[model samples]
Target: MNQDTPMLPSIEPATLEWREGQPVSARFGDVYFSRENGLEESRYVFLAHNRLPERFANLKAGDTFVVAETGFGTGLNFLATWQAFRDQAPSGARLHFVSVERYPLTSDDLRQALSLWPELESLADELCEQYPPLVVGNHRLVLASGDVRLTLYFGDALEALGELTFEADAWFLDGFAPACNPGLWNTSIIEQIRQHSRPGASLATFTAAGYIRRALADAGFAVQRVPGFGPKRDMIRGDLPPDGQNTGDGNGSILVVGAGIAGSLLARNLADRGRTVIVADRGEAPGTGASGNAQGALYAKLGVQFNDQTRLSLAALLHAQRYYPANTPRVWHGTGLLMMAGSEHERLRQQKFLQQNEYPDRILTPVSAEQARSLTGVPCPHGGLWFPGSGWLEPYRLCTTLLDHPNIRTEFGFRATRLLPCNNRWCLSGEGRQDLIADAVVIAAGHETRKLMPVLGEFRMKAIRGQVTSLPSGALTATPKAVVAGTRYLNPPMNGLAVTGATFDLHDSDPQERLSSHQENIAGLESMIPGLLSCDDLASSVSGRVSFRCTTHDYQPVVGALVNGDGRVLDGAWLFTGLGSKGLMWAPLLAEHLADCLTGQPAALPRSLARRVDPKRCLAEPVDTGVPVG
Candidate 1:
């Protein structure tokens, strides 16, 4: 969809009230949990009825059990299930809890509501800390040091489960009373649950309504009535028999041709999900390519209009902000970011962005010049966009940490020169290195990927050369506490140096840094923040880096599976390049999407957003620089 398409509305925070120290939903006129021992009620209804404890213990090594719920009113059920899974499941097993909520509780309200149960304090604390911004989409949280995963869909329950891609082993048929919220128990919702349920999947609910039982029974579940919790007498339970449908793809060995952000993250994600991942890169270490930026920005650069690219970037930036602290803490912080309006054109663009979209200020806000200066600890020429949840991080360190996983085998110096079919697997080999065969392969070698997979030429991605000038921290009079960007970016100091400039040159593949590029960067910096640096006279000790970045004509990354011109698979090959320059902010979410597409799990992005990064769009769409490229 283009800019003319209406933007997806933001989710409103749940209006809650307290009745006798128990939280009640103001909208539905229902209590979030039973006033009589909510935790016990949760365990008796969802955990016990679904037989989760026994099922958790029965899971094989490396097995991931999925539990889906129609509503996540207070997270009481999820916490109880998590506690049980941890106590009873084997160490090697993982648990994925998927739940939907149209109106999510505010973090403060959630903390206060959950404070009623001290037994679930620890798990509740983590859940509250990792809770997503109340946005109208899915948010994936990797908690318990990656052993437990949660995907919270903040939209209509039916639409969520319809787009969701996963096989649930157990279902928590939850929501308010059928009379209060019939949408959650409608035929469409039942059909989606049945469609996602595994053959032997079991379901339990606190209600035993006849229509609900009949709907589930018609959808292939063997319905039963069970004893309920609290004042309820009878509850519903069911087991779905298989429909003989083949779920595409299996957990298998995968070969990733690049150890850059996209490839490294994708490899590690697949590995964490129980796939054996072999990472092959030509460099002696991770991020030696374009991913080797010393300090990179982690903010979404939205455009003047809410187009597909801007929408995806916003979603990805939010996802990555959550991912870093969840998966790898202390690597980065939300010290925040400032995008200066250095030019009149940019000033108008930033103004238009604010006017066109009604995004929450918690994500981004238009700041005055004084506010920008106050936020960045520098002089600001013009009012710009301020992102409170954005910052910078070392890409090299990120790649290294991601590749240092047991499930991911890193071949640092393996330059994958060829990709062809061998036996039933894809063979990835280079000039002298040993051939590596895997059930699937991901080509993420930036521009060089086109050489390995000739069919990628149809995708029309380009290799652009970029340069970033670095100045020692000691060289600057005062450094911005946060990352600042205009025509060029000035990141907070890393390795005793602050970085700026990145001359975006098309078709130039020079590996050597040029003085002209450094001058251009310094000039841009001078124009953005006049007295921030004395860089014009400080070139004697200046150092910079040059790298070739893969970018599409439209500047969006190409992700997911690649099909040939005739709409056939290209021998199990996947493409994940064209990240342009926002790899740090874009990599995490896009990598998660590729992993989902590969493993047949729930999607990280909606279909329309995902299509913007599809190979077909990157190939077929004409370049329209009508708006600023985010």
Candidate 2:
């Protein structure tokens, strides 16, 4: 796949309508059917027949079940199921509903249709708020305060089902009647459904046609005839026997190498879920990777129009700012951020975006160069967007705080040299053959992950060495109230020292601290803040540290499941690397996403943005030209 090509499935168009005073919905074009019965028809034919209330009774804390559906017109069946689950299940249990819909109704149409159920209004509102963009492929939405996850495969049911892998606890065969939609009821679709069913998985549908029963039986379901809900005479209900059980859940133990932000955050999330996780790194303590910087700024840049990268950055910035802790040992001064108008075109573009959208004016402001100087306590050639909520974070301190949770065990000075899969478990080996095993593993060792997984050797992840120079506060009479950005960035003085950086070296990988890069960084800062101080005086108080940042071809971080061996196996392993210079702004949210996928919890970020960070795409495609390289 080309880097520019979007990894989304195609969607087909279809129409839906509700039968007035009737409980049925009629889909037009490829499938046409009516809920000839009332809403009770859905309850009896879909819910009771599948024995859902009883299944809910069996759920325990942290338990999750998957439900697969053939059709999702109007989402009535989903809404009903969500309401039922919310009323019946235990507090901590989660439900994942995987539904396929070739054509999805507009938000307005959904609101109108759902208006028939006044009781479901609140849930309907949540759904509308998180509705996916009118695009194809899998779109995930979080509902009911993150307990109910909905993954909508908006495309051909058969093709989309083929792309999904799930162990469903129940199946809602709510597609149009067999006669109206034979393509959906065919044996091929039934077989695909059978592939995802777990042992004793029950299924319920409103149809009792002969071919439907025969096809389902042939596809592995033990079909039974049951009295239909409402006026319908009969319906089909049954269960699929268990295939084979593989221990994909890493409940026993796991080894995570790299104690930086990625590995430490992963450890915290896993430990919170009661999993025993050990975080290891070569350094004597955690956060010694690229995360050891004194301070890093958080901000998102937008291009002229909404492109893929721009959209992704916007979504990430929103999600991260909402979730990252507001109070920590590390200083979090909302010093805001200043993105100078380096060019006239950029200034015009920023102005246009501000005028078009009702974005938080408190977070962003347009000002003149003199006004920018007043706000930031520095001289600027041009004014640009000012983000008030933006600030700097002590990366090392935050990483250590995330590891402070009791469930997370840390092991320093243990560098992982090899990762091998043995007996359906991953074993990390190094240092005199000391090994630790786990049902699942994550490779977050920055650029070193490619070395461990040879299949990813061809990926475009590069290690760009960088150095940040620290100068005495005497260089500036007044500390900046905000971080200033243009060609370089300068943070407000902290503890009598102001940090400014960083010099980028694309050709270097060695971690050796270089004086030349430090000098260059000081020069870069002077260029951004002219008349601040001379290089000679700044160099006298300057100190620096070097680190390498992992970067992907597209500048987005790799944060999902790993694809290995010619796509034959989606190795239980995952990744959370390639954060590059945006670690402070992107890591917290990306780590939350990886945690959601692991715990089967609802993702906080948009599905489109999530795909941009999926680790599998890195192995499948070449470098993306969408990112701007400095």
Candidate 3:
């Protein structure tokens, strides 16, 4: 898929009405919940039928349970389940709730609809705060201090469910009335659900249609009819009997090499999902590599012509914009970003990006020179593209914050030099000595990863050095209110300092800060904003940092299972390197994807985008697994 491919159309927001003070979907011509008492009806139909209260109470320490639902109308069921899990679940237990919605309600609609139930206000507000866009893909929201996880797939039910990689512990079959929305209850969707269900998994639905019962039974469920809530007399419930089918939730220990943003994010992802994670780094602390930069810009790097690289970058940027704020101000700043039209060629490219894609203004808007200056509080030479959700953050702060999770342990100065597999486990050794042993290992040491995995050389990875110059805020006439990027970037001031200038030197490994590169950065900055800074100010500036960034020829990160020269997958081994300069934007998304691959959870990206970053894509030879690399 390329830029010429049409953008995935967003799901139309549900048009809702009021029926006896309860919200009703006009499209389906059905009430969202029982008009008699929506809260009680939800409790009776979903929670009671699924035995959630008992399950929550029985969860042992370090256990994780997943509950999947078909329709996430107003997120009432999710909130109810979250509240129950919070009130009754074991202290260290985790809850993963996955839901699918074809037509999601707008934020305003959800707020208005949920207002009827003041009892669910807390959870509703949390959901609203992290609500995702209406795009056709997955949005994983980690809530309640990383204890409750919500994965919302917005698209057709069958297509969305078919892409998921995890097995559900319980299913909530609630997609309007089966008669009104038969597509969601079709045999194919049911079969997909069955295939993605863990053995002994139970399902509950407020409908007892004969065909539904027969279809579920035919798919290997022990179906039964139970009393329904409200006026309905009967509801359907089923259990996938054990019979050696259940794949119990057991996440093994994982050792992540490199404490940079990539490794930190991967550790957080694994630890949040109940896996014990050990992070090892060659340096004395985290973010000592490229991720140690004072400030890194976060935005989708697009080209005049869209390619697989641009698509993956866009997806990663979108997910990062939404997910990075789970820990705001302390780690990130949502001050917005601006890409200046510094050159005529880039101005034309920016115009093409806007004309080719009908992106939401909030995501990317073409701003006039005057508008850009007013919005950013800086003098601008030309109109540029503004990303309201994009911003910059200190990479080290964010990496450390992510590693603060209870399930994550950090081993600084423990450089992993070799990955040796023994007895179905991986032993990561550093300097000819075993440093850590784990069931799985991920090599994420940026450019240095090539030394640990020689096969990575086949992918043509390069280490490019970058230097960023920082100046005291007083050096500028006025501080920019947002990040301004073009040939260089002038980030919003933080702690009385503003940062700009990153000279991308290909094939350079020197970490020494250079005055020549600093001058080049200033030249680029002046080219972007004509009179923003004078040569005297740049000459006086002395603070800067130089770090090595890893990149691949295709400009895509290498993720997924690591394969040997013989075209065999190294079991329990993964590679997550080659992020290059976009580490800030790509780390969180790819880390989550790697976590999903390891834990057998739903992938957060589409197959097309996922394949573009597959570790096997750059193989010297592509093997025919007949599995399309998904």
Candidate 4:
């Protein structure tokens, strides 16, 4: 399918009319109260029927309840729930409200509708602030100082419910009346909801329709008719009979293949969450992937105009700057980085962006060659945009630090041959005779994921073999304080050696360990820093490593749930690969995102951005271009 075509189903808005102090509507042919009545109906039918105030008071400290809703119209239900939770629930208890909305109203409409609740102004304001970018998929909004979390699924109600990985303690069946919205009241939807309900999960809705009650009863819920909220005569309330059997909460174990930055960081985050994680790699040690380089620069290449890649890169850069640890051997020097101004057109674009976006002044500054030398401690013929927050990091050391987590187990020389999904777990076969069973698995093994999982189809990944040459620090006029970029990138001395030039070669995948590429790297370095070093000086300092870097056409790292044929993620099978060269900056944040999704916590990044990183996204949509090999 092309980009212009919709990948998923879409819905139309319901028709509305004002009736007897209630705004009524017909959604999917089902009658519903659009505004006033809908808001009040939710407050009484859903909240009151669940006995929320009493339940909230009884919750233990730090305990959280998952509340799933059939529909999220105008978000009145959510706002009301938040208000009640804040007022009645103990400070330590958290309220997680997950709602499915097909046709979400625009921000303006939501704001106007929310204005009717004068007493709920504070809670409404919090909701409006993190209302998300309105793009499809899951959007998590943190409210009440992060105590309450609202996860909005903007798509088909059934499809959205399927994507949810949480077991609800309560359910709000507040879609349009059963007759008006048969899709919401159908047996299939009820069965799916029941599948995600924990024992004793309570449910309530304003309609006591017989079909709805029957569907609920058939789906394991004990249903009953109750006094309706407001002027209505009746409503429906149900509960999942207590199992009295605790199916011990299973420990979610994940096997992350490849110990590069991506896998190591993934291990770190999982370990932090008290998960038993194993990082497997064929190499003798970690960072033996493309991350074996001595020093790698950190900065986003600002495009002429902000495209999707540029926006993603900018967000990734900022996220890295804020979260990536600074105290590690990865030296973070505030000495700034210089992106040499080449063409007149490019310089103008940079100038325009500087005017519009208020970037951190201490981080980015436009400078001339003279100013650049004064700040960088080295002379340069061309001036460029200086990014002070950007600096060099020892990639191997960062990878090691990330893998240093106590719970992370690293097994070397374990090359995975096949993955089989069996009985709610993944069995990974390799050098070991017994298959390794895990609740989850992340394939951070780069371009090799395709070979491992043929079912993934074709991914837009290129294994670009790169070789970097290191020049001795003594060859320079003065040890450069900052990293210099253009056709070639030169970093300041780390351990008396300056590293530069990773000549990207797509024709070769086998590790050749070629001298020609090292010579090309030296030549490129000389062009960047004129008269600083001779061929002999550069070649003498040429002592760096080489590895294949896997990248996608869009340059965004894949990081999320892996969809499988059985409507479940092949037991524990997952992929964290295709990071390519930007792994240094992208791994930490993306790892956290994957960890959050696995733990059922609110995602840290925007839903659109998260989908862009999802491994399955490219499976459905093909990427037609390759980013220029740097």
Candidate 5:
């Protein structure tokens, strides 16, 4: 939970030796798998013992089967299980495999290790292509067109597993031998494992150590020692006793207000989980609100040190990068991001931040002025941070694509006037059409959320107006290869055009294009890059758009279940608003969280972070100054 605390040294990549044409780990002094037949050994020890084939086959149309693993050593077990699910499971069922790894192998090393087994080559290649950078966080990978999802936790299992908030239907206890790695089989860890397992969860482990058996038994699992594969005499298999948790009925209709990034994503995620979704917006189409920006940077803006906000931003950034497709031609440009130190004070802050943290270079690399210029082709006056995984996205395109789901029904040119309850369900009524009824309702209407639901008035959502200017690509003598930000941002050329200047005005809701704002943008560019552009060159030809962004007083998004005036959470109403400026980076993961809350599944974010963004947070801790609504 202490995200700011320094991470311990990463796991050293396993050194291997060829023994009888089998891979042997030099560190653990154990074979990666049985020398006689590794693939068959994995299938028998994990799949057969867990009864995954039957479990997967029995899954209903909208059900999700989650499998958690202790170690993801060559990902051999994951690939075999994926293949089994592909062969045996229904098409509508989804497989969510969460694996924790201390030291991850390089892509080249993984390729070589997986090359030993040709049977899993296809799955191995897919995993290799999407393998995340060596960063210490969750990297969610959606494969096979969203049928299979893999969340790889790149850190020590002991620390990483505690951060995860998901209930596993099956567990793959596939770490090293208990005799060699006793830390992994400790009592506390076994208890944590039990905490994250759903009722009647099945578990499989190759080790049959008596200590581990006792640990599993004490942790509430009805464990049993069973026949092992190959030469091994016995393995451990068990099932956790049922724990009372509300598993929602699959057939529920929901209505989502707004069709921007937040609502579109929430609608799609719900639809993916087999819920009928209705997305209502006042615009002619989706992304006509704040998400209609031409080009927005997709990276976390961190402070000098990590805090709750920065930690949440980093998680959201990582999740968006992994969940959304970034190379969909005109949709997203994975050109990386550069944040410049425009002033001496900011330069000192950057230096102090880099000196205090030992982050992986892939996550954030402190670059010198020369390095920044060389990498981005922008002459940043001072050194800054470079985020390799950041990029620029066309929000309108992204939202439209997300709303293209089969289960999503869009109602454009319509706005809801009131939220009324009918027969325990919700009704969304407007002026033109008949009332729309649903089992649940989600309010994602940006700044108009608090206005629509008076109970949320305590959250005090503020509307911040922002304007972005765009110029012809040829206007600049040189273009940055990536998005460069200091006082303002300059995205790389898209469709022979480049965008700049998003001036933040807290109390201004004027949507008209302003020449003064364009001049300010040009000044901003001059400060970051001395000779990029001049006011005279772009003052006459620049085009810009303005939109209002919404945020809460504490700056955390108002997500999760809605709370009534009496402080009880409304059963079928949710709020997913107040994302402010971080919509592109934050929307996807928050959408996942909302979906979890709706489906009675485990949360995707930490509970601490979740509580911070809860809709009732403002009510729980009343602020001295009330929320402002204009």
Candidate 6:
């Protein structure tokens, strides 16, 4: 699962031309679908040949059917498959569709193309609503009221399939004609397709060329020619032998220690996948740890040097943009954010970060002082990078929502100080609670995670205490339209209060409110925005919260399976903490990853990038996330 990928390219939208109401790809010089019978063509070539209808109907409750596709052109094929699965599959069944697209249709274009079928309008509307920005990365969407999951990779098909980790039961080997877009049908792609296929997995393609059939056979699939749909004469379908076994690696009833963002998200993800999950916390409530901040900004601390940390941060930010809006948008906002130029050091970092990473303006765009003022009502001194889809949210409220799944249970005031093996399961017991038995356990209790490590004097993670003070909006002369951050952050007023300070104190664990911390926050704000806050701000009515963030010595999170002193993963134990101050940004995607590891599903990120956060990453090879773009 190493990600040796090139700098991600901004997706150039597919340009389309209308030919008698049929959409044709300008780049590939191919029709997206047949104007005559595209829907039936999809049903005939993919669903029927792949045996999805019969397979879907046979699925037991809690079963998931995985599908991968080479091209997501117009999404007609996917839509057709989705409808068929819902029609055939059991109520508790799930469909996970993974698709790769080099040139994605703009959301507007997707809507227009889908509008051809009035019957699919409802599902089409939902897809368009959750379609991600044209950024090269994985965009996973939870659709069909959680019955369908779509993980769309907006990148080259071969690279995505090569790096992507999933065992697909079926594959729609689709794209433009091989005569024109043969790269997708090349040996590398065919090999990756076979590599990712599950034993007895079926594949269907629109082409019936002899070489394609030969390649499929050579790749160990039982290949055959089939009658095509509509004007096409023939297609191909293939199945890998059952002996080609590639099995799942995750499972069992799980217990998550910690009710903060990390544990709650992990519990929720597992519960969504039908795993029984119990969340235990020392506090009486969720997010009452590091995630207890009154207001938390949903952004990342991007690096000036593009490294694994930077790549991870960038990926987390992009995934978060789609995740929050789709899952918790009601609890937060994407109004935008401005990281103002603060110190000479910070200004240089911002300039270098922009120059080294040439991302699309939608992800980051620089603004002038005047533009900054226009965007944020009262900003004049400096201008920096503008994160268009970043904002702040109530962290506790988000945690509460994530843990509300039907299959997830919660235990508050459950301090887990001892973990013991019992009958192939794990026993979690500590003060204030009885021993809880779970098939597996994940320690996500912030800094307290270190206390649970079996082979540890100290588990390479430390506590960094932070405090944030909230000032009522009535006390401020001006409020920003968006969140603002530099040395400190300023959130847009919510419920008549605009939140400001967060003193970063290293190696400290005091959880008490302090007047000095309040004064320091106001001082930093006044220094960043000269006239925005009165000097007497400390005297005005203000309240605050203090919490400890758990961070690794290297500052990456401790994710993946919990490893022992000899580097072997402990049986029935996993760790999902060490998010530091970026839990709001990191939890969404990393939680998806840890859940995959714990549940034996495909990983959300490749191991190269994931290794940065892996508990025993130093024992692994060093990560190289390609050169800086531009």
Angstrom error of the Cα, residue 12, model 5: value is: 6.2
Q: For residues 228-336, could you state the per-residue lDDT of candidate 2 as single tens digits?
A: 7556688999987765763133355656778887787778767765567877787888888788888888888765455556656655564445335332535456677
Candidate 6 global TM-score: 0.93
| Cα lDDT of model 6 by residue, 216-329, tens digit | 999999998988888889899999888744343444789999999999888888887888998999898998888987788888877776666776788788778877878876
Measured by C-alpha RMSD in angstroms, how accurate is candidate 1? Answer: 3.9
Higher-scoring candidate on lDDT, 2 or 6: 6
Once fitted onto the true fold, the runs of candidate 4 whose alpha carbons sit more than 4 angstroms away are 1-250, 326-334, 343-349, 355-358, 432-434, 454-456, 534-537, 563-571, 620-630
Task: Give the range where candidate 1 is weakest over 10 consecutive residues by summed lDDT.
Answer: 621-630
Task: In candidate 2, list every pair of residues with a backbone clash.
Answer: 24-35, 199-242
Worst 10 residues of 2 by lDDT: 4-13
lDDT of all the models against the reference? 0.83, 0.71, 0.82, 0.71, 0.81, 0.82
**Could you give me the TM-score of model 3 versus the true structure?**
0.93
State model 2's lDDT: 0.71
Which ranges in model 5 have alpha carbons more than 4 Å from their true place? 1-27, 241-249, 326-330, 454-457, 534-537, 620-630
RMSD of each: 3.9, 7.9, 3.1, 10.1, 3.8, 3.9
How good is model 2 by TM-score?
Answer: 0.65
Which TM-score value belongs to model 1? 0.93
- Using all chains and alpha carbons, the TM-scores for the candidates as numbered come to 0.93, 0.65, 0.93, 0.62, 0.91, 0.93
Better of 2 and 6 by TM-score: 6
- Candidate 1, which segments miss by more than 4 Å at Cα? 1-9, 243-251, 304-308, 454-457, 539-541, 620-630
